[model samples]
Target: MKLHFKIEAEKATSDIDVTIDNLVVAGWAGRDHAAIEHHIEELAALGVPRPSAVPLFYRVSESLALQGQRIQVVGAETSGEVETFVFSAGGILYVSLASDHTDRKLETTGVALSKQICAKPIAATAWPFAEVADHWDSLIIRAYIVEGGSKVLYQEGPLSSLRTPQELISGYTDGAAKLPDGTGMICGTVGAIGGIRPSSNFTLELHDPILNRSIHHSYAIEVLPEVA
Candidate 1:
């Protein structure tokens, strides 16, 4: 399964191009679930999945991956809310106004998606300078890597507001925020025809909407399917 997504802008409007390369998998007799799931995950190459025999979608939101343009401008130079973009694991898109800013760099942070585990943060190197100067309203703030296992994690943030870096890094509670939890049914029996299966060596990637490029980091994670 090949899953490729590319977002770009032309004529001042953003465009999203998504492609899912569907492939067929042969289920052999006596093969365990791990072996099959491993091969299946490879099909999508990772994040993207084929809707064969099973149904799944990565979360997304307008604030995550979608383009950010002013919903309504109050007055020029008044500094309206900053639009943020996000890609939820559920395949939904988020595009809206809200931000975590600071007077300094590497000194601010977004709220954790959840307390169960600390989500990885990748602040935009081009932020404030590239994104802000270029007027790119949205940018990716964090990325996370979780052990695969037919699970779900809920994210709560993009609080539809703005605050100082000091407040966000310190976990301020006055504004809207994303509080996520990953949960899901593990593996079903071999005869199961439909279910979400976790992946080995799970990896996460984040992008800067304004810069239109991936952040300078990637997180490769290994969890679940423990071996002795």
Candidate 2:
């Protein structure tokens, strides 16, 4: 998948296009072990199986990465969670906003399968990781869902709530310093506010308070009938 992005660096901004062949979704990646367990238990309550390892890495198709404002799902049993997206482009790592839209029903069967069942939406803008590496924890991530024509906050927390990008990249690469070029990963997200539920539209945002800027994207969900 070729993704075009505007790289917002400390000094200048440039447009770059990169091809991503490997896409991985990091799960159970909370910085606090207790919080990680809490999320695990929460999913378990929904019938999703427990993960075999902490910070589990699930490889998803690169084609699933989407920049559009709308996505189609098999049924109404799917929802989106906002997460920070990290990718390497031109030898430089960049940070962006993305939603790991997932099938709640299929999640009970297999987490990996559920991840592959829906389109992953991402923001077209990104900031160079180096620009925010010093205060990465200060970055905030948030998600909102439209329910009954009203936008409600679904999730909100600082990036510190989840594992850092360096830790995630190292864990995924077995102690490697950086992700291979053309690889993109969506770091785990914070728990939902009310609960995980489907919505007609989902919005994701990544705010960098230090830089006084944010990346935002919204997408509508089109639920298609599941004919068995």
Candidate 3:
């Protein structure tokens, strides 16, 4: 089956189609000298081990819902903000925003399974990586959560906080073929503002001041009843 994603093309007035075959998420990708130790400590408190490498790749399904789509989750107490990198088969790389919508409760049990629980939501548009490569470190990622009626800043930080896209792609390849065409990777996210918590709605964006453009996407979370 084919997977489709929306994109605001450079020439098109409306969104266009961006197809892919695989989706991956890089984890424990913090670039700080203490990044590994920091994540280890963070997850250890919750009973998880720190990965051996700074950037570990988790391959997710390509089948994903687009922006504005309502995704259902069971026991998903929170959604982490993230930026998704899209690899076009023709060799064009683009950047978009996404929420690695996860089930926090299940996270305590299994990180991969917890990640597989919800339908990932991604932006309807994307920005060419070539245009932002020079100032890539300046790109910013910001996410907001709708609790009750107001939107609260859930996470916000610059791309510099995490390993560069090239570094991540290299690590993920690990002496293998370069990330093939039709591959989409969700770059790791920054720390949460007030700790992880549930939200009825989630919104995220990737801002590039150098190019004066941003990629944005939002979705509503409909928590399904848990049945054993």
Q: Best candidate per lDDT, number?
A: 2
lDDT of 2 by residue, 1-228 (tens): 999998877789999998989999999999998888878887887899989998999999999999999999998899998999999976889999899999989999999999998889999999999999999999999999988889999999998889999999999999999899989999999988977889999999999999899999999999999999
Tell me the spans in candidate 1 whose CA falls farther than 4 Å from its real position.
1-114, 117-126, 133-197, 224-228
Enumerate clash totals for all models, in the order shown: 43, 0, 0
In model 1, what lDDT does residue 77 have?
A: 12
Q: In candidate 3, how many clashes are counted? A: 0
The alpha-carbon deviation from the true structure for residue 36 of candidate 3, after best TM-score superposition, in angstroms, is 4.6
Q: Candidate 2 — what's its lDDT?
A: 0.92
The lowest-lDDT stretch of 10 consecutive residues in candidate 2 is 37-46
Listed in order, each prediction's TM-score against the native is 0.23, 0.98, 0.88
Compared with the true structure, what per-residue lDDT tens digits does model 3 show for residues 42-137? 666666555656677877777753455688877657565566565654566766777887777777787877777777787767766667789988
Candidate 1 is scored at a TM of 0.23
The lDDT of each candidate is 0.24, 0.92, 0.73
Candidates sorted by lDDT, best first: 2, 3, 1
Better of 2 and 3 by TM-score: 2
- The global Cα lDDT (0 to 1) of model 3 is 0.73
By TM-score, who's the top model here? 2
